[model samples]
Target: MTRTLGIMTEGNDVEALYRRLAWRRQIVLLTGLAALAFSLVLDVATGPAMLPVPAVARSILGLAQDRTVDAIVWSIRLPIAFLALAVGAALGLSGGIMQTILNNPLASSYTLGVSAGAGFGAALVIVLGVAIPLPEAWAIPAMAFLFSGIACAGVYGIGSLRGSSPEMLVLGGIALLFLFQALLALLQFVASPEALQQIVFWLFGSLQKATWPKLWIISAVLAVSLPLLLLDAWRLTALKLGDERARGLGVDVARLRIRSFAIISALTGVAVAFVGTIGFVGLVAPHIARMLVGEDQRGLLPASALFGALLLSLSSIASKTLLPGAVVPIGIVTSLIGVPFFVWLVIRSRRAFW
Candidate 1:
């Protein structure tokens, strides 16, 4: 009887430990999410226009008497802030899944060369003036999205032909990256000075081009993809245990990889289509999330999304405020901020996350 009582006490202690771990993950996720929200408000409030938080809130609520403030808040700052959040979330989630499925900590959305393909497609439209059925604004991102999908398909095809090894996928991605980069260079070489300048600026990845329509489109993509990703959370976590182990545990590794690749391609394509290539969010956000929450995909995925949103939102705020009246391109700011964190991530730990 005493032995059974002791066993029950031990079990209770184990259960309590699990509860504490769960609570820690919850706190990390909530804190990251709250930070993202606060950063969004700051992003909307700052910038060249410079509105206070109260004023920005009032403008959002339609309680502001000032038409100019309303226009600035609703038409400009709000869209940019929302796009930052959406794009960041998509990239972060995509990155976390890519790393999990591939079992490579370095894997990211850009690892499959989706960004390069999108950039090439956008360059073709900008430099050669390719005509599409849509308006100029819509046409560029449309072509970008199309080519990104094509690039991902190519990588998958090549990887499958090579038996879909992780190394094969990485090799295929490298090939696509070089291929699309070369094509973009060729276009730039032939481009007129004016077109060349536009291509350069587009490649710089600025959120200054954000619009309400673009915001809605990206938000829609995130809304659809994030839930799907979360639904696969358990399976994705199984994937981190290596392909053989995952297969032994009843996961169809090949099918999951294919499906995950497709979803990642769509998410990444939409993101880069609108904002160009914002690097490092995919690479860095997952690392931060993993460090905070460990490898459980259920918690890691949402935390990654939150951290990604926070990083990009903070970058957006910095980009606008770096100079008095001039806005810096977001891509540059992200690189500046991401490089330090990336270096820290590399140097700070010798432990294996996977």
Candidate 2:
């Protein structure tokens, strides 16, 4: 009888805990939505065409829809901002998933060699100048995504061979990353100077080339991927308890890992295909979201998505405004900022960070 009472009491405690967590997440979600709205306005306002803030707001609200303002806001600034936000969210979600599945905060979409694969693909496209009989623009991004998927699969297959461990997986990814990067270098050596420039610029990353069509494609991918990720949020939570324990809990750990890897690869591939490697948002946004909303995947996922989107939008604006005319690559800006902060975080949170 006493044991029964104790079990009921524990159940009540768990229920209470979940309720409190849900309430907290609701508040965080609301805040994130409000922030995203503000970011949209800011993104529209911050560009070369010095429009009045009031005009930007009025145009956005459809109260003063001048053709010039519409062109500037919709055609130019809005798409670029939205693309940055989309790419940022995708990378962040990808990183969060990778980190959860691996139980390692350092694991990211880039960590597993997807970026290298995309780079190689883009390199091939640039070096060969193969038109693909499509628009030059479409061919570049399409090829990048294709190569990125191939790279991710190759690394995963090699790492998951019989008796492979996490260490082996990490080693394999690192090996592939360096190997592909070296191959790109060799390709550059044999290519003409113009091809070298194209390859270099693609690697550097940019929103300079953002287009309405590309934005829609990324949005469609995100729409599909984000829902699937949310649906598997429970499995992701189970995964944090270790694969063996998760398996004991009736979760198919291997299948979950593979699904996560594929989704992550697709996300990273699409981003790299369009914007190249805009690094660090994926790694940093999840950590920040976790700090705010706790580690529960249900809340953590959406919060990370919102925060990542806003962070990248702000970074894009800064990249352009920080030096006017000479737009610094978003990847350069992120790496410059993220690397030091990450190192410091590692030092400070020696226990939790690793």
Candidate 3:
């Protein structure tokens, strides 16, 4: 009778602990959503041609009394804000997925060379005058998308040759990074001064390039890919138990990796193609989310996405406000902001999140 009472008490304790964790996760998610909302408003309202918060809201709701204000709000700031949110969410989601599958906290789109490949493809179009049948604006991003896919395929193929070991995939990514960097340098070496300037600026990752069409493209991709990821959340969680253990549970480790790689490449490619290479969001956001919510992918994934959108939206606001009348490249801003946080994250935690 005493043993039965003790068992009941222990089970209650376990249930209480789980309830506490669930409450904490909910709080984190809600906080992230609130931050994202605030950042979006600040980004749209605090630009060079600043608009009042109420005015911005009115314009967005189609009740603006001024045409110019409406145009600025609708045509420029709104799209840029939305793009930042979408791009950040995509990067965060991809980062979370990559870290889980690769069993590497440091794994991200930029580290895996997807950004370098996209950069090379954009450079080819911008510097070497490579043309496709697509419209002028679509050409560069299309090539970037294509090259990013090619790079992921190359990395996967090389890794597969060695049984698709995580270390092999990391090594293959590093190799591709250097190879693409070399190719970009060669293109820059031969580029005309004007073309060189364009190439360099594109690499700087600006949201000034945001358009409704590009935002739609990114949104469509995220809409498709995010659901697939959420559905695979359990499998990804299984992978955290180590590849051999996961495979023993019928996870099909190799197939999961391949599918995830393709999805991540697509997400990363679309993001880099439109916005240039915004680094560190993917690398840092997941860690932040993991630290906040533990390793449960169901919560971690959405929390990561929310944190990412919040970070980039804040970055967008900073880029505009840092200078009195001029905006800086967002990539520079993100690195400056994210690197310090990343260092602190490493220092603050001694426990492995996995």
Candidate 4:
């Protein structure tokens, strides 16, 4: 007699996976919409003017036409909301991609030092008086994107040389992060007190400086980059297995890594440029998305983007409304929630990141 151990993909597993994806997509879309509506409401209702929810809604819809409400909604809140969603989405998706590529759960815009690079760049502008001469509006993110790109490039190049390893990538990122932090410190040391204050504020992060133009720039970056990342979702998902494994399955590991690095760099760079170093959303949102959607890139990537948008939008609203009189910076709010979540994620997934 011969006995065989049988392997099967349970019908329940297949149905459960599909059902979960459908449910998650619907939930993500609905919650994302709800978060948007709530963001609009908070935009009109939470400012110094404090308009009623219905009136604020009407003004947004262009039905009321009250100048003050319209101005507040259009000139102020709308831009802020849009920036939060767009940056949040970019960070979220970047974090997801980083984790997938590195196979590390703690990977995020902040944790991996991408934000530190951007912060250092912004700090340079603040200290050197270079960015100051430019339109005050374009300064921060300009420096941010530039530095983030360079820093990411540095990390990737060092990590992907012949016979390079993931360990080198993580180590290099950490080292570069400290290097940038040192640069920020040196800039702060030579700066005047007032200039130093500006640098400090940017380092901590804020949305108080947000405007419609800046929002447009950030939104444009996301619009251009997100589709490209999504288009490569299949190759990205394949990266979860080892590069050698992916190659055996006919994936071009080198090309995939280069493409992913560029996309992640741009995503994180744009976000840090616009908003400073808002932490936790990218790391947390993608993990949440993975938990909900399994490992499929098609579902996982969009889910991270949607959830990220909702997370940041909600955080922005909370920072504004929670204090009742003082408008909290979006970064502060995110860090408060993010730091703890990150700590927990790392502790839980010690094998991955540690």
Candidate 5:
């Protein structure tokens, strides 16, 4: 009777421990959301006109209507600021999903060739001057999204030949990365000087070209993708235990990975398609999220999206303020800031947080 009581006591302790962890995760997510909100207002306020944060906030919320403030906020800066959040969230979520499904801490859309494929497609349009029925603005992103899908198909096709094992899929991605890079280089070699300059600028990544339509497209993609991925959250968490274990858990491990990969491709494609090739958000945000929230997809994925949006919003603010009048490309700022911070995170974490 005493031994039976001890087992009951142990079970209660385990349940309490889980409740504590869950509470802590909730706090972490709330903190990230708070930070993201602050950063978005800051980003809108930091541009050359230098509206006060309260002014920006008031304008954004329709609390006040100064024509000058409204024009600058609604006409100029809001699209850029909001798009940064959307793209960052998309990349962050994509990175989190990719890392989880591939069982590789290092995996991301940028590393795995989806970004490369999109960049190549954009560059091809710029160089060849492709004249589709859509306006030039729409044409490039259309092609970029298209090629991003092709990259997903390529990864899936190649991986399936080897039974869709994670190792085989990763190898296929690396090979495609190289292939796309080489194609991009060749396009650069033959491109006209003007077209080459355009290519170079596009590759640098900027939010300067942001517009309401582009912002809506990405926001819509995020809206659709997030719920769908969240629905599979339990299966994704199960897959982290290892393929055999996940299979034993009645998760269709292969199907789960493939579905996740396709979603990552679409997210990455839409992100880079509009803004060009912003890199480190996809690679860094997920690791930071995982460290804070652990590997449960419900927490990890949304935390990753929040952190990613925060990082890029911060980057966008720096891009404007860094050079005082000339806006710096956001991609440069992200790499410069993200690399050291990422390395520090990697070094400081003593255990394998993955």
Candidate 6:
């Protein structure tokens, strides 16, 4: 009887500990979301015109009547600001999944060749023109989206030949990365100077081209993909414990990995399709999210998305402010910001995040 009471007491204590941890994780997620919202407002307010934050806030809320301010807010800043959020969320979510499924801290579309594939596809359209009857504006993004999927499929296909192990998939990704990069280089070598300039600018990544249509497309993809990922949150969290353990927990490891890759491709392909290739947000944001919320895919995934959006929104502001007048390419700003931070993250951690 005494032993029974002791066991019950211990169980209660464990339950309380879990409850506290869950509450703390919730707070972390809420804080990240709040930070992301503030950053979005700041991103919208920042630019050459530099609308007052209050004015931008009013404009956003439909309370402002000043035509000039409304036009600037609605027509230019809002789309860019919102697109930054969507793209960043997509990248971060993809990165988190990649890292989880592959058990690699550095796993992301950029590292796994998906971004390079999209770049190659865009370059193909730029250099060779769309073989299909696409509107001139649609050609590049369509091809980019297509090839990103192709890269995902290619990696999976190659990995399948080697039993689709995580190591095989990563090796396949490395090969795909080199293949697409070489193809891109070949296109650049033969590209006319004007075409080459356009390609380079696209590669540099910019939010200047953000439009309502583009924002909607990215938002739509995010809307679709996020729910699918969240549905498998438990399965994904299990995946973090390695394939043998996940399978021991009744997960079909191969199927889950394949499904994850499909979603990752959609998230990544669409993101880079529009924005070119913005690196590090995917790579760093998930790590940040992991630090805040640990590895529960439910909290971690949303946190990763929020932090990703926050990072990109902050980067957008810096891109405008860093150069005084000329807005730098956001990709360059992200790289500059990401590199040192990434180095710090690598050094500061007491042990492996993966």
- Candidate lDDT (C-alpha), each: 0.86, 0.81, 0.89, 0.78, 0.90, 0.91
Q: For every model shown, what is its TM-score relative to the native structure? A: 0.94, 0.93, 0.95, 0.88, 0.97, 0.98
Candidate 5's C-alpha runs over 4 A off are: 351-353
Predicted candidate 1 versus true structure: per-residue lDDT over 204-308, tens digit per residue: 898988998888888888888778888888888888777788888998889888888888888888899999888899989999989888888889988888888
Order of candidate numbers by lDDT, starting with the best: 6, 5, 3, 1, 2, 4
Candidate that would win on lDDT: 6
Tens-digit lDDT track for model 6 on 1-354? Answer: 999999999999999988887998989988887888789889999989888898888899999979899999999899999999999999999998998888888889998899999999999999988696888678899999999999999989998997888898899999999999999999999999999999999999998989999999999989998899999999999988888999999999999998999999999998999999999999999999888778889888888888888899999999999988899999999999999999999899843355
Worst 10 residues of 5 by lDDT: 345-354
Q: What's the distance in Å from true for residue 195, model 3?
A: 1.2
1-354: candidate 3 lDDT, tens digit per residue: 999999999999999999999999999998888878777877889888889988887887789998988889888899999999999998888888888888888888888888899999999998766869987578999999999999999889888889998888888888998999999999999999998998899998999989999999999999999888888888889899988988988898998999999998899899999999889999999998999898888898998888888889988998998989999999999999999988888888854244
Evaluate residue 293 in candidate 1 and report its C-alpha lDDT on the 0 to 100 scale.
87
Clash pairs, model 3 backbone: none
State how far residue 310 of model 3 sits from its true place (Å).
Answer: 1.0
Please give the TM-score that candidate 3 achieves against the real structure. Answer: 0.95
Tens-digit lDDT string for candidate 5 (31-134): 99889999999999988779989989999999866888989999989999999999999999999998888888778888888889999999989999777788
Residue 82 of model 6: what lDDT?
Answer: 96
lDDT, model 3, position 111: 86
Which has the higher lDDT value, candidate number 2 or candidate number 5? 5
Pairs of residues clashing in candidate 2 = none
lDDT, candidate 6, at 50: 85
Score candidate 5 by lDDT. 0.90
Q: Model 2: what TM-score? A: 0.93
Q: Clash totals for all models, in order?
A: 0, 0, 0, 0, 0, 0
Looking at model 5, residue 315 earns an lDDT score of: 96
Q: Which residue pairs show collisions in model 4?
A: none
